[model samples]
Target chain A: MKQLTFDVAVIGGGPAGLAAALAAKEQGATRVLIIERNLELGGILQQCIHHGFGLHRFKQELTGPEYAQRFIDMVCRTDIEVMLETMVLEITNQKQIYAINQTQGMMQIDAKAIILAMGCRERTRGALRIPGTRPAGVFTAGAAQRFVNIDGYIPGKRAVILGSGDIGLIMARRFTLEGAEVKAVVEILPYAAGLTRNVVQCLDDYGIPLILQSTITCIHGKERIEGVTIAQVDQDWNPIAGTERDISCDTLLLSVGLIPENELSSQVGIQLDPVTNGPAVDSNLMTSIPGIFACGNVLHVHDLVDFVSQEAETAGCAAAAWASEKQYSSTRIIASTGKPGPCCPTSDSIPFDGVANECCATWGSTQIIIKPGNNIRYVVPQRICPDKKTTLYLRVRKPDQDVSINVGELKRMKHTFIRPSEMIKINLTPELLARHQSDYLDIHVVKEMVHHD
Target chain B: MIKTVICTVCPLSCEVELTISATNEIEKIMHNRCPRGKSYATTEHIAPRRTLTTTVHIEGAIHSMLPVRTYEPIPKELLHQVMQETANINVTSPIKMGDIIVRDILGTGVNLIATRSM
Candidate 1:
């Protein structure tokens, strides 16, 4: 086994890793190594050349590549060593990383601290369990992005995006820009899962119709996707009879969800959050294991790349602090409920009107929010760090005609419609707390009181 | 005449209602999100400049050289002129992403550079 050494090792060269490496170096970490399993750095940003990133950090509306270039340029100025086309096989609790590259077949590196910024992976068709014939035309949104943006190959002429996630909405426009006709964006949930701006710019501006409360029940194709059978779904998610419609299309793109890439985190023996399927960390972004930090999508699926950069900066500074013997003791861990939304509303109702009772379970600081079984999609605050300022994120299961989120006595943020796919963020501040600290908090979603401004 | 301009600094493109208040003195700024916007609005009222980035072809290389922007910003009206002039130029492959294609091209002491890798 080959041995190497660095003051800090950053895994996964995405925006988070790049920002982490840069921040660590700026914060006094002498030797930093960024290991990435790609021919170049920038991770998913390479495929996302669209404008939306860098608003918070650079104070400019920059494209993904442009935003990444800013950080990449910063890395070049520092003494940080970036290892491209490198893969990290495993990481140990002792801060030892096992990796491989063309130059070094297999090697071991021991560092004082390691930053896990491996990012997240897109949830695919297999995860969705969409009933379909195995065809050559189905592709993940990321794969299609790579094809069109980098490889210069359009996935298909006529496309149908099967999820209202940000990627799906962006791709709907991307395909159209490349001269492809995007028929419609079909989302099972009634509310849009993407950002409101994306819904306006990518869909509404481009005139792409968004079908809600619907799903592709069956895919029709032989060697390739010829068409699909879409149907309106009932409250139980079952397809409503006589509501099926057949649309002709050659390709299907899934932008259903994203899951944090935590395989290395698990190998390192870090305490994993059952809800997020990522590691649990404190304010400094240090994971359960000291000297090991996780940031960006690896910590949790972030809605925006700007957040990824911000979170990575925290992780990088924390890692540098750990190396310099800046110790943080007696930390009260705040658990993040994987289910995110704008409001945390609670009601003392059993077999609630539109909520799921079976999925309720307490994990750390998170509580299973109860709602009407049929209406609410997912609730956040899986656990809340009572004393600290935390944000509870949630969304409706599908788009509703009108909705209002109620969290105890506090007034909820009114929304015309809410979708489960679009994760909602609610700032939980000290003023909102009725007491210094509480054992648990209850949350729920209810019909919006009809009101107009 | 005093002109009202919007600041495009961030997503919150604040519509800045600027009152020139004649030659040196100015007041009446509104709807600005951050300090950056307010500063930009004041600066634009006096002297307007923009940062520009475009590609320059590389000799004997399949990919083009990315010439990038330098300094604060250049005049917005000169954008088309700069792009047209830079479109006809080429550079070498040893160039980095932000490498300067021309030094003080418009006598503004600002350099042109590459934006993305080819």
Candidate 2:
């Protein structure tokens, strides 16, 4: 193995890696190398043929490739080095990275700082534990997307997507536009986990029906996917006795969820957040190992690529600072103490022991509990420390109107808005916490408005 | 005639109503959420452009053809004409995604390029 050196080694060439490399250069890093597993530098953005990205960041509705090209062009004008078709095999505690490239064979990189921007991977059928025979027509939504958009091969004429995630929704439209019939988008959860705009623009506008609280119970086919059995699920997600229905289709696409690409991060001894299935980092986005950092979907699942770019910018600058030997002590571990509750940013199976002295000090008990309220899907920061400013994100539990969220002491933030598919963000400060001293935080939402005035 | 248009330039995609006088004089506009929407509606009600993505034959490659799209917005009505013109052309493979194939093919100053490799 040949040894290479750089000031920064970005592990993924997606939006996060591109932004990180560019930001690191702007922050005065001398040498930067970006390693990408794909043949291109855009990451998954390459397969995203839709035109809903870069609205906030670029102020234009650019397709995934267009949005990615803007950054790729900027990186080209810089001194950054991009290595495509390069896969990082291992990352060591000492910031040593081992990678393989067809041309280079085995290569080693030793950098002052490492950025884990590998992004996330789609969770497939095996991970979902779906009882079915392995069929050729079954594909993850991303894989199907690549087949239709990039590879120029139509997966099938009739399709059924099993999850209402953004990718699944976008693919529904893509498949439809490509002349394939999308039968339905079946989601196990009562609400969609994608963006509100996606549900409306990609599905509703295109006339793709969404079945809520439903799941594919079994797959039927021998040589290929011939049909699927869908059943209406109960509150506990168990299929109701007689609600099973069969839909004939040639293909099945899964958009269940995404798992952070943190195998290398974990191999390097970085603490993992089981909830986000990403690396555990502090406010600065630095991982457990000093001088190493992570951002983007690798840190947590992000609904928007613009947010991924912003997070990567922070990680890049922080990496530059760390390379300069800027040091800070994390004497206290503000962990989520107590039984790993359902919303503890960890395992959902863990039982809740409620508030305890050992609860992550970040919670501090004076904190407000931001759980999934009525018609609200899920809220982040299951427990928030009012002492420190925190931005909480929540998804609507269902399609709602005139929805108003009344935070204990704060005036109701209301308007006709919000969808189960979209996540809403609200920032809470210490000043607001001082006024509300309730032991258990209460959140009530009501729909009374027709539209936003 | 009064025209209502949806500005698909951004995610906001505001729906705007434009009132036009018989003499072609610009009149009042309502329901536009932002300044961008107002300008977009004004331009769209008169002329509309759309981005196009289609495939053309590619020779000397692993596959028969590669997907290509316009680099910028093209006149909506001319989409069929542009498609017909490119339909006969064959691009040689080893083409990178975003590599410009025809410079300003439609005279809209927008280049047509391969969207994905063969």
Best by DockQ: 2
A119-208: candidate 2 lDDT, tens digit per residue: 889999999887767777999999988877666778899999999998999889778766789999999887777765577657875689
Error of 2 at A87 (Å): 1.9
Question: Could you give the DockQ of candidate 1?
Answer: 0.10
* Candidate 1 regions with alpha-carbon error over 4 angstroms: A326-453, B1-114
- lDDT of candidate 2 at residue B8, scale 0 to 100: 61
Docking class of 1: incorrect
- C-alpha lDDT (0 to 100) for residue B100 of candidate 2: 88
Candidate 1 interface RMSD to the true structure: 6.2
Q: What count of clashes does model 1 give?
A: 38
Candidate 2 lDDT over residue span B1-118, tens digit each: 7776766655444557888899865598887778877887777766766676666678787556566778877876776678677767777878887788889986888999876544
Cand 1, B chain, TM: 0.75
- Computed on C-alphas against the true complex, the DockQ of each candidate is 0.10, 0.20
